[model samples]
Target: MSSKQRFIKSVVATAKADAPAMPWARGARRAAFIAKRSGVEMDKKAA
Candidate 1:
């Protein structure tokens, strides 16, 4: 897969891995993943 695709997959995997332990972190990770995929930078403070 291409680098971009690989990044997306990795982000998803990471979010999944973190979900069970920390719900907030998982949500942040998911938001960040979506932002990254959309070529935007998420506001960390907001998250």
Candidate 2:
């Protein structure tokens, strides 16, 4: 597999693995995972 594909696979795997039990917490965790992996700052909270 290509490097980019491998990265995506790993990202999904990690996101799934780190998901929380609660639905709301799971969504937050998923968002955090995406932001962290994409190297984007999540300083602003959603209103």
Candidate 3:
């Protein structure tokens, strides 16, 4: 799988395993993951 796809799958797996506390954390992770994958920095406005 591609890095991006792997990242997404991992995030989903994590979310499923830790649903309660994973909501915000999952969002944060996804934002950071997306930024890293796209070679861009995450901005507060976008987050």
Candidate 4:
């Protein structure tokens, strides 16, 4: 179980690391993705 969990985590981490984030965007898409994964509610009013 531990090894499987480690492998999954590593895969996700690697995918994140390989993704492109432009200099102007500063990884905003990645931040939203991580927030969504953690069940954070997006505030449409602010957006």
Per-residue lDDT of model 1, residues 1-47, tens digit only: 99999999999999888745565466676878778899997787855
Worst 10 residues of 3 by lDDT: 19-28
Model 3 compared with the native: what TM-score? 0.40
lDDT of 3: 0.81
lDDT of 2 by residue, 1-47 (tens): 99999999999999988955775566665777778899987755631
lDDT (0 to 1) per candidate:
0.79, 0.76, 0.81, 0.74
Writing each residue's lDDT as its tens digit, candidate 4 over 1-47 gives 69999999999999988977565565556666666899997665433
Model 1: CA > 4 A from native: 20-47
RMSD for each of the candidates:
13.6, 13.1, 13.6, 11.7
**Whole-model alpha-carbon lDDT for candidate 1:** 0.79
Model 3 lDDT tens row, 21-44: 554567766887778899998877
In model 3, the clashing pairs are: none
lDDT of 1 at 19: 47
Which stretches of candidate 3 lie above 4 Å from their native place?
22-47
Could you tell me every candidate's TM-score relative to the true structure? Answer: 0.40, 0.40, 0.40, 0.37
